[model samples]
Target: MNKARIAAAPSPAGLAFRLVFAAAAILLALLSLPQAGHAQGIVRGAQEGSYEGNRIAGPVGGAVGGVVGAGVGGAVGAVEGVLGIPHRHYRHRCHGYYDGYHRFHCYR
Candidate 1:
Protein backbone atom coordinates (compact mmCIF):
# COMPACT_ATOMS: atom_id res chain seq x y z
CA MET A 1 0.00 0.00 0.00
CA ASN A 2 1.21 3.52 -0.92
CA LYS A 3 0.23 6.63 1.07
CA ALA A 4 0.18 10.11 -0.41
CA ARG A 5 0.68 13.23 1.75
CA ILE A 6 -1.99 15.88 1.48
CA ALA A 7 -1.52 19.64 2.06
CA ALA A 8 -3.54 21.17 4.84
CA ALA A 9 -4.81 24.79 5.01
CA PRO A 10 -4.79 26.86 8.22
CA SER A 11 -8.14 27.07 9.97
CA PRO A 12 -9.96 30.27 10.97
CA ALA A 13 -9.53 29.41 14.65
CA GLY A 14 -5.78 29.19 14.27
CA LEU A 15 -5.68 32.52 12.42
CA ALA A 16 -7.78 34.18 15.11
CA PHE A 17 -5.59 32.79 17.86
CA ARG A 18 -2.44 34.16 16.19
CA LEU A 19 -3.97 37.58 15.68
CA VAL A 20 -5.13 37.76 19.27
CA PHE A 21 -1.69 36.71 20.54
CA ALA A 22 0.04 39.33 18.43
CA ALA A 23 -2.30 42.07 19.63
CA ALA A 24 -1.82 41.10 23.26
CA ALA A 25 1.98 41.09 22.89
CA ILE A 26 1.95 44.53 21.31
CA LEU A 27 -0.35 45.93 24.03
CA LEU A 28 1.82 44.57 26.80
CA ALA A 29 4.96 46.04 25.24
CA LEU A 30 3.37 49.46 24.90
CA LEU A 31 2.11 49.39 28.47
CA SER A 32 5.59 48.58 29.78
CA LEU A 33 7.06 51.91 28.61
CA PRO A 34 7.85 54.51 31.27
CA GLN A 35 4.92 56.83 31.84
CA ALA A 36 6.82 59.51 33.72
CA GLY A 37 7.57 62.91 32.18
CA HIS A 38 11.28 62.20 32.63
CA ALA A 39 11.14 58.99 30.66
CA GLN A 40 13.07 60.45 27.74
CA GLY A 41 15.78 61.82 29.99
CA ILE A 42 16.15 58.55 31.83
CA VAL A 43 16.44 56.57 28.64
CA ARG A 44 18.98 58.91 27.09
CA GLY A 45 21.02 59.04 30.27
CA ALA A 46 21.14 55.29 30.54
CA GLN A 47 22.27 54.91 26.96
CA GLU A 48 24.95 57.56 27.21
CA GLY A 49 26.19 56.32 30.54
CA SER A 50 26.35 52.73 29.39
CA TYR A 51 28.27 53.68 26.28
CA GLU A 52 30.77 55.86 28.11
CA GLY A 53 31.21 53.37 30.89
CA ASN A 54 31.81 50.52 28.52
CA ARG A 55 34.29 52.60 26.57
CA ILE A 56 36.18 53.85 29.63
CA ALA A 57 36.12 50.71 31.71
CA GLY A 58 34.26 47.44 31.23
CA PRO A 59 30.95 45.69 31.76
CA VAL A 60 30.83 46.47 35.48
CA GLY A 61 31.54 50.14 34.91
CA GLY A 62 28.82 50.26 32.26
CA ALA A 63 26.20 48.95 34.71
CA VAL A 64 27.17 51.47 37.41
CA GLY A 65 27.30 54.29 34.90
CA GLY A 66 23.83 53.47 33.61
CA VAL A 67 22.33 53.64 37.10
CA VAL A 68 24.04 56.94 37.93
CA GLY A 69 23.16 58.43 34.56
CA ALA A 70 19.52 57.43 34.89
CA GLY A 71 19.23 59.15 38.26
CA VAL A 72 20.87 62.36 37.07
CA GLY A 73 18.85 62.40 33.87
CA GLY A 74 15.58 61.86 35.72
CA ALA A 75 16.34 64.74 38.11
CA VAL A 76 17.24 67.10 35.29
CA GLY A 77 14.12 66.13 33.38
CA ALA A 78 11.91 66.70 36.40
CA VAL A 79 13.47 70.09 37.06
CA GLU A 80 13.01 71.18 33.48
CA GLY A 81 9.43 70.00 33.52
CA VAL A 82 8.68 71.98 36.70
CA LEU A 83 10.47 75.10 35.41
CA GLY A 84 8.45 75.07 32.18
CA ILE A 85 11.64 75.34 30.15
CA PRO A 86 11.05 74.63 26.48
CA HIS A 87 13.61 72.65 24.53
CA ARG A 88 15.29 74.90 21.99
CA HIS A 89 16.41 74.05 18.48
CA TYR A 90 18.81 76.41 16.80
CA ARG A 91 19.38 76.51 13.05
CA HIS A 92 22.41 78.38 11.67
CA ARG A 93 22.49 79.14 7.98
CA CYS A 94 25.36 81.07 6.47
CA HIS A 95 26.61 81.65 2.94
CA GLY A 96 30.26 82.47 2.42
CA TYR A 97 32.64 83.02 -0.49
CA TYR A 98 36.42 83.17 -0.67
CA ASP A 99 38.03 86.15 -2.28
CA GLY A 100 41.18 86.07 -4.45
CA TYR A 101 43.13 87.16 -1.34
CA HIS A 102 42.05 83.97 0.44
CA ARG A 103 39.69 85.92 2.69
CA PHE A 104 36.54 84.22 3.80
CA HIS A 105 33.30 85.98 4.70
CA CYS A 106 29.88 84.70 5.76
CA TYR A 107 26.55 86.44 5.19
CA ARG A 108 23.24 85.60 6.76
Candidate 2:
Protein backbone atom coordinates (compact mmCIF):
# COMPACT_ATOMS: atom_id res chain seq x y z
CA MET A 1 0.00 0.00 0.00
CA ASN A 2 1.39 3.37 -1.09
CA LYS A 3 0.66 5.91 1.75
CA ALA A 4 1.22 8.92 -0.54
CA ARG A 5 -1.38 7.77 -3.11
CA ILE A 6 -3.92 6.91 -0.36
CA ALA A 7 -3.43 10.31 1.36
CA ALA A 8 -3.57 12.25 -1.94
CA ALA A 9 -6.86 10.64 -3.12
CA PRO A 10 -9.48 10.68 -0.34
CA SER A 11 -12.69 8.74 -1.07
CA PRO A 12 -15.71 10.97 -1.90
CA ALA A 13 -17.92 8.73 0.29
CA GLY A 14 -15.61 9.24 3.29
CA LEU A 15 -15.57 13.02 2.77
CA ALA A 16 -19.35 13.18 2.46
CA PHE A 17 -19.84 11.07 5.60
CA ARG A 18 -17.51 13.30 7.68
CA LEU A 19 -19.20 16.48 6.43
CA VAL A 20 -22.70 15.17 7.29
CA PHE A 21 -21.64 14.01 10.80
CA ALA A 22 -19.88 17.30 11.51
CA ALA A 23 -22.91 19.33 10.39
CA ALA A 24 -25.28 17.26 12.58
CA ALA A 25 -23.08 17.67 15.66
CA ILE A 26 -22.78 21.46 15.21
CA LEU A 27 -26.56 21.79 14.61
CA LEU A 28 -27.38 19.88 17.78
CA ALA A 29 -25.00 22.01 19.90
CA LEU A 30 -26.50 25.25 18.57
CA LEU A 31 -30.07 24.03 19.22
CA SER A 32 -29.27 22.98 22.81
CA LEU A 33 -27.62 26.28 23.92
CA PRO A 34 -30.91 28.25 23.70
CA GLN A 35 -32.72 25.56 25.67
CA ALA A 36 -30.08 25.79 28.43
CA GLY A 37 -30.66 29.55 28.75
CA HIS A 38 -34.43 29.10 28.73
CA ALA A 39 -34.30 26.42 31.44
CA GLN A 40 -37.50 26.21 33.49
CA GLY A 41 -36.94 26.52 37.25
CA ILE A 42 -39.23 25.29 39.99
CA VAL A 43 -41.62 27.86 41.47
CA ARG A 44 -43.21 27.47 44.92
CA GLY A 45 -46.22 29.26 46.32
CA ALA A 46 -49.06 28.86 48.84
CA GLN A 47 -50.89 27.24 45.95
CA GLU A 48 -48.14 24.84 44.94
CA GLY A 49 -48.24 22.74 41.77
CA SER A 50 -45.46 22.47 39.22
CA TYR A 51 -45.89 22.66 35.48
CA GLU A 52 -42.58 22.33 33.61
CA GLY A 53 -40.97 22.90 37.04
CA ASN A 54 -42.94 26.14 37.44
CA ARG A 55 -46.09 26.68 39.51
CA ILE A 56 -49.22 26.66 37.37
CA ALA A 57 -52.99 26.93 37.87
CA GLY A 58 -53.85 24.02 35.60
CA PRO A 59 -54.23 21.29 38.24
CA VAL A 60 -56.32 23.37 40.66
CA GLY A 61 -58.68 24.49 37.92
CA GLY A 62 -58.93 20.96 36.57
CA ALA A 63 -59.74 19.53 40.01
CA VAL A 64 -62.42 22.15 40.68
CA GLY A 65 -63.94 21.61 37.24
CA GLY A 66 -63.89 17.81 37.77
CA VAL A 67 -65.72 18.05 41.11
CA VAL A 68 -68.32 20.48 39.78
CA GLY A 69 -68.83 18.38 36.67
CA ALA A 70 -69.33 15.26 38.78
CA GLY A 71 -71.97 17.02 40.91
CA VAL A 72 -73.82 18.30 37.84
CA GLY A 73 -73.59 14.90 36.20
CA GLY A 74 -75.01 13.15 39.28
CA ALA A 75 -77.90 15.59 39.43
CA VAL A 76 -78.71 15.09 35.74
CA GLY A 77 -78.38 11.30 36.08
CA ALA A 78 -80.68 11.22 39.07
CA VAL A 79 -83.27 13.30 37.25
CA GLU A 80 -83.10 10.99 34.23
CA GLY A 81 -83.29 7.80 36.32
CA VAL A 82 -86.34 9.02 38.21
CA LEU A 83 -88.09 9.94 34.94
CA GLY A 84 -87.32 6.47 33.49
CA ILE A 85 -85.43 7.99 30.56
CA PRO A 86 -81.81 7.77 29.50
CA HIS A 87 -79.71 10.93 30.00
CA ARG A 88 -79.80 11.73 26.28
CA HIS A 89 -83.56 11.22 26.03
CA TYR A 90 -84.36 14.39 27.96
CA ARG A 91 -84.67 17.81 26.32
CA HIS A 92 -83.75 20.94 28.31
CA ARG A 93 -85.24 24.44 28.43
CA CYS A 94 -84.61 27.78 30.15
CA HIS A 95 -87.39 30.04 31.47
CA GLY A 96 -87.63 33.33 33.33
CA TYR A 97 -90.69 33.80 35.54
CA TYR A 98 -92.33 37.17 36.16
CA ASP A 99 -94.16 38.13 39.44
CA GLY A 100 -94.51 34.52 40.61
CA TYR A 101 -96.13 33.60 37.28
CA HIS A 102 -94.57 30.67 35.44
CA ARG A 103 -93.79 31.10 31.74
CA PHE A 104 -92.94 28.04 29.67
CA HIS A 105 -90.83 27.97 26.51
CA CYS A 106 -90.78 24.67 24.66
CA TYR A 107 -87.41 23.40 23.27
CA ARG A 108 -87.09 20.04 21.63
Candidate 3:
Protein backbone atom coordinates (compact mmCIF):
# COMPACT_ATOMS: atom_id res chain seq x y z
CA MET A 1 0.00 0.00 0.00
CA ASN A 2 1.21 3.49 -0.82
CA LYS A 3 0.10 7.10 -0.27
CA ALA A 4 -0.23 10.04 -2.69
CA ARG A 5 -1.29 7.80 -5.58
CA ILE A 6 -2.50 10.83 -7.46
CA ALA A 7 0.94 12.61 -7.41
CA ALA A 8 2.79 9.30 -8.04
CA ALA A 9 0.58 6.62 -9.55
CA PRO A 10 -2.22 7.84 -11.77
CA SER A 11 -3.50 4.57 -13.17
CA PRO A 12 -4.51 5.30 -16.73
CA ALA A 13 -6.76 2.25 -16.84
CA GLY A 14 -8.51 3.31 -13.66
CA LEU A 15 -8.90 6.84 -14.95
CA ALA A 16 -10.16 5.59 -18.28
CA PHE A 17 -12.63 3.24 -16.65
CA ARG A 18 -13.91 5.98 -14.39
CA LEU A 19 -14.43 8.36 -17.27
CA VAL A 20 -15.98 5.73 -19.53
CA PHE A 21 -18.28 4.38 -16.84
CA ALA A 22 -19.36 7.87 -15.85
CA ALA A 23 -20.03 8.84 -19.44
CA ALA A 24 -21.98 5.64 -20.12
CA ALA A 25 -24.01 6.04 -16.97
CA ILE A 26 -24.83 9.62 -17.86
CA LEU A 27 -25.76 8.72 -21.42
CA LEU A 28 -28.01 5.86 -20.35
CA ALA A 29 -29.55 8.01 -17.66
CA LEU A 30 -30.31 10.78 -20.13
CA LEU A 31 -31.66 8.32 -22.70
CA SER A 32 -34.20 6.97 -20.21
CA LEU A 33 -35.42 10.43 -19.22
CA PRO A 34 -37.93 11.12 -22.02
CA GLN A 35 -39.79 7.89 -21.31
CA ALA A 36 -39.83 8.67 -17.62
CA GLY A 37 -41.12 12.15 -18.40
CA HIS A 38 -43.93 10.60 -20.46
CA ALA A 39 -44.72 8.23 -17.64
CA GLN A 40 -44.84 11.28 -15.41
CA GLY A 41 -47.47 12.84 -17.76
CA ILE A 42 -45.21 14.75 -20.14
CA VAL A 43 -46.78 14.68 -23.57
CA ARG A 44 -43.81 15.35 -25.86
CA GLY A 45 -43.06 15.28 -29.60
CA ALA A 46 -46.38 14.82 -31.45
CA GLN A 47 -48.87 14.57 -28.61
CA GLU A 48 -47.85 17.88 -27.12
CA GLY A 49 -51.14 19.81 -27.34
CA SER A 50 -53.90 17.26 -27.91
CA TYR A 51 -56.67 17.52 -25.32
CA GLU A 52 -57.08 13.73 -25.26
CA GLY A 53 -53.42 13.46 -24.33
CA ASN A 54 -54.40 15.66 -21.43
CA ARG A 55 -56.56 12.95 -19.94
CA ILE A 56 -53.76 10.41 -20.04
CA ALA A 57 -51.66 12.92 -18.19
CA GLY A 58 -54.34 13.96 -15.74
CA PRO A 59 -54.44 12.68 -12.16
CA VAL A 60 -56.47 9.60 -13.21
CA GLY A 61 -55.50 9.71 -16.89
CA GLY A 62 -54.90 6.22 -18.19
CA ALA A 63 -55.88 3.60 -20.71
CA VAL A 64 -59.47 4.11 -19.71
CA GLY A 65 -60.75 7.09 -21.69
CA GLY A 66 -61.14 5.45 -25.15
CA VAL A 67 -59.63 8.61 -26.68
CA VAL A 68 -62.36 10.69 -25.07
CA GLY A 69 -64.18 9.45 -21.97
CA ALA A 70 -63.54 6.11 -20.30
CA GLY A 71 -62.48 2.93 -22.20
CA VAL A 72 -59.72 1.94 -24.71
CA GLY A 73 -57.70 4.81 -23.43
CA GLY A 74 -54.43 3.45 -24.80
CA ALA A 75 -55.26 3.78 -28.52
CA VAL A 76 -56.60 7.24 -27.99
CA GLY A 77 -53.53 8.10 -26.03
CA ALA A 78 -51.44 6.97 -28.98
CA VAL A 79 -53.54 8.88 -31.47
CA GLU A 80 -53.56 11.98 -29.38
CA GLY A 81 -49.81 11.73 -29.01
CA VAL A 82 -49.54 11.57 -32.80
CA LEU A 83 -51.75 14.62 -33.31
CA GLY A 84 -48.75 16.96 -32.89
CA ILE A 85 -50.73 19.91 -31.59
CA PRO A 86 -48.58 22.73 -30.29
CA HIS A 87 -48.59 23.22 -26.58
CA ARG A 88 -49.98 26.40 -25.11
CA HIS A 89 -47.51 28.85 -23.61
CA TYR A 90 -48.12 31.52 -21.01
CA ARG A 91 -45.79 34.38 -20.22
CA HIS A 92 -44.69 35.40 -16.75
CA ARG A 93 -42.67 38.29 -15.36
CA CYS A 94 -39.64 37.85 -13.14
CA HIS A 95 -36.47 39.74 -12.29
CA GLY A 96 -33.11 38.68 -10.88
CA TYR A 97 -29.59 39.91 -10.21
CA TYR A 98 -26.31 37.99 -9.85
CA ASP A 99 -25.34 37.35 -6.25
CA GLY A 100 -21.67 36.38 -6.36
CA TYR A 101 -19.00 34.70 -8.45
CA HIS A 102 -18.28 31.82 -6.03
CA ARG A 103 -21.68 31.29 -4.41
CA PHE A 104 -25.09 29.88 -5.26
CA HIS A 105 -27.52 32.04 -7.22
CA CYS A 106 -31.28 31.83 -7.04
CA TYR A 107 -34.33 33.46 -8.67
CA ARG A 108 -38.01 34.05 -7.96
lDDT of each: 0.83, 0.48, 0.49
Which model scores highest in TM-score? 1
Give per-residue CA lDDT, model 2, range 1-108, as digits (tens).
666644568889999999999999999989655332121211121112223223334666545545555555455545544455643443445543334455445432
Q: To one decimal, what is the Cα RMSD in angstroms of model 2 from the true structure?
A: 17.0
How does residue 98 of candidate 2 score in lDDT? 33
Ordered list by lDDT, greatest first? 1, 3, 2
Clashing pairs in 1: none
Scored by lDDT, the top model is 1
lDDT of 3: 0.49
Can you write out model 3's per-residue Cα lDDT over 11-84, one digit (the tens) per residue? Answer: 89999999999999999989754343223233322243344555657633433232343223334444444564
After superposition, candidate 2 runs with Cα above 4 Å error: 1-57, 89-108
Candidate with better TM-score, 2 vs 3: 3
RMSD of each: 16.3, 17.0, 19.2
